[model samples]
Target: CSASSGCGTGILANYFDHYTVFNKPVQSGIAVGDFVTLEISSSELFSRAFMLYIFPILALFMGSYMGMRLFPATELWQISFGIFGFISALLLTKYFVK
Candidate 1:
């Protein structure tokens, strides 16, 4: 877990922990029946993490820059723009994933 990125797996696990609707059961610690699977490679995983984490940060910077240009150099407006940028990045990420 330490040698590689496991945050995505951790997120899935936490989600499953709270919502049993997607949980599955195995009788002998083995997949014996219909099971869901995903075909993802390590490189793809890393790329996804990179996009998810870095894109928002980049958007934040761009948003702050635009905010500075459009509004007064006030802390509140800068933070608001940062948040808007993050949300826009998230929306874009969702679209890309689909």
Candidate 2:
């Protein structure tokens, strides 16, 4: 177990002979080099995937649509709004994922 990025607890382990690092809580009595089991629910995985991938795209499209309606003469405004929306969604996703 060791400190990961963002100062969270993490574990470095070997899986399928490849070294991988996971940011997860460690139980008491567990030590480095000890074997442990990790499990993730399908629903949780799906939710995370959707938030990380789909949500930002949806936000960008919505923003583009709104910008087009509000600024019909300016393509620049539409693209700016879409980029802003994508960035906002990423920030929100980061906050919620934790």
Scored by CA lDDT, what does every candidate get?
0.75, 0.85
- Residue 88, model 1: lDDT of 98
Pairs clashing in candidate 2?
Answer: none
**Per-residue lDDT for 35-65 in model 1, tens only?**
7664579999888987778998999988888
Question: lDDT at 16 for candidate 1?
Answer: 47
Which pairs in model 1 have colliding backbones?
none
lDDT of 1: 0.75
TM-score of 1: 0.55
Model 2 scores a C-alpha lDDT of 0.85
Superposed model 1: Cα runs more than 4 Å off: 1-12, 16-43
**Candidate 2 versus the native: TM-score?**
0.68
For model 2, what is the alpha-carbon lDDT of residue 86?
A: 94
